[model samples]
Target chain A: MAEKVIAGRTIQVNDEGYMTNPSEWTREIAAEMAKEEGITLTDKHYAVLEYIREKALAGETLTIRKIGSSGIVDLKEFYQLFPGGPLKLASKLAGIPKPTSCV
Target chain B: MATKEEYPLKKVLIICAKGNLEDVYAALVMANGAVMEGIETKLFFTFFGLDAITKKRMNCLHTATVGNPALRMPGGLPFPTLLGILPGVEAGVSAMMRKEMDKLDIPPVKEFLEMITAGGGEIYACKLAADMFKLKKEDFTEEVLDIITVGQFYEMAGGIGTQIIFV
Candidate 1:
């Protein structure tokens, strides 16, 4: 019924549990959130976030375990760059209407 | 933005069966795309997929040729399997793929994985596959979140707006 900001992205949830601003969020918002999370934003981060956001908008879901198995060797450094780490960054970026029970 | 009753697949599970460059890259691209679109993504490595995450063999991924329609020979000729077995065949293909990926500014597999995971996607190893491959948990990518079975994978994938993909 109201718009809420989760991970720097505005998401509107209806009474029937639907998302209004599903695709409104952008990679820029993800970057801003990363900065707000006290992680320095880099071109690499932008690239990754942009890629992720694009996929999610295309109707795909991502998991931390999948991300880890993707062979990105610099995982620790990347997570260290984030305050809450990759999962938080992704959850924030996804603009999920509510906190997931799994997390 | 108007609330849509049905959201697109908000979660994805990528099943990796081969560890070749193309296979691994395909998985990464999908995962990256999922994260970008605000979806939760996961990649499951089984069989040869483990090679892509294994530090020792990650850089050694080869090209697929047998029964591949995309295979080509010099001067537009079709390359035979014998040619594919030549010493530099795999290396040459791998190099070309890397070059193209570089031109597109795609990060290396390792970095791309990091970005996806760090962005909120999860990465897991198939426990059966790992055991079959005689791989210890330590042999997997350092970023691996867990080793799970197919049932566990299904459990994670269960929910509305979830997709399961094999690559």
Candidate 2:
């Protein structure tokens, strides 16, 4: 486990850089992480992030194409927003565990 | 700000070295999964993997049943190696595999590639393989990004947070 200081708030993160405790996540933390990923947080990105958090809170397992089919964003836009790895990166930014099916 | 190299596990590069139905699908599933995970994903096709993107063979790909230890009949019966060598057996097995994939609503090879590329995945073919097979650039589907040498391939794979997977 590793600790990250975002907005003067300390949060626990896994070795993969995912927040280990969802309760410690905040909009400030998300913004900080997004900046680190070279993205400027926009409403579109927030919509996807919040969608992930909502589904994670409800105990759902999400895959890349699942989000593509969600109609929040098309597959192409999803990739554009989260270029490297959409589901894993989004979940990490959203303070959720990496989706098990991603690997 | 952290440099790109400092980032751990940034992108995924999947190498599809086999052209068989199962092998190509395995690579596709993983690459597509990576993209959905918001990971940057690139797939490199080498040797027989070229069949996956070849316009003529992509749709006609077949499952390899011969000497495949993990293959089983529809009823969970073990697939006998001897039975796999018989005429039409491989095609039957391939048809069965396609049917199962259809039941799961999996897309066909071409469509799957389209979906992956549209989702921001990159696709490339091996230059050596293409030359050996006498394939020209126009011989492949529109989704292929380029035909590159091994050296170029490694260079592309070299990046922070990038993981190279062989399937």
Candidate 3:
């Protein structure tokens, strides 16, 4: 229930700063969001984020197990990309809400 | 002025002591969840739980059809214990459970352990139980880091914001 100005655009967000509207996401915005977490976006990082945004916004349940098999990156790489809380951080940078699945 | 202080869980020690399908899964799910949260996770398998880490038995775990009051028929009918003793019935039920979990993207026990470790979770076997069962390190999957005693387990469990859970 807040608005964040990222990459020069005011976007709706939740209390935790997760974007409320996935459609408002842009590559620039994602980079900025990741920078806040002290992560620099690389091709490999964007690959995982883009994949999840496409599937999760389309009403798919996202989990590490599913993402591991997405062919974009493996499970170990996913953790390395997002460091702390891979699924949660990936979802946030993807401009989607925090992931809900446990696995 | 008063300030808000947040004390988040920094580490978790989970102990699994059962080999039944549901029991082992409960431990796996909790351990995996902790790892996903970026928590420092440690899992110790002892007693019957050792079967879960045993290379030969990890993927072939079974649901205890008998002596389990919670088990039920497909349509909510109270399951009769007599049917549990029937050959293949328990196996069939366990298979169905696996199928259901698979549909939800839950991996088998072996793969689950891999996922946890891939996220930096540590797995260990209890030395006392390992001796009682006459099992050795080679009998466990590559996922296990070592076989250690309770004292060693506690040594690592020490720290602020750390919690130990027994299942």
Pick by lDDT: which candidate is best? 3
- What clash count does candidate 3 reach? 0
Instruction: Please write out the lDDT profile of model 1 over residues B1-167, one tens digit for every residue.
Output: 99869766778999999988888889988887676555888999999899988878876677776656687765677868876777887788777778776665566777777777766788999999899889987887787899999899988988888999999
Recovered native contacts in candidate 1, as a fraction? Answer: 0.09
Q: Which residue runs of candidate 2 sit more than 4 Å off their true CA positions?
A: A1-38, A57-59, B1-15, B29-42, B82-89, B95-108, B115-121, B131-134, B149-167
Candidate no. 1 TM-score: 0.61
Overall lDDT per candidate, in order of appearance: 0.69, 0.85, 0.94
lDDT of 3 by residue, B1-167 (tens): 99998889999999999998998999999999999999999999999999999999999899989998999898999889999999999999999999999999999999999999999999999999999999999999999999999999999998888999999
Report RMSD (Å) for each prediction in the order shown: 10.2, 5.5, 1.3
Better of 2 and 3 by lDDT: 3
Specify the poorest-scoring 10-residue window by lDDT in model 3 chain B: B64-73
| Separate DockQ for every predicted complex | 0.09, 0.33, 0.90
Best model number under DockQ: 3
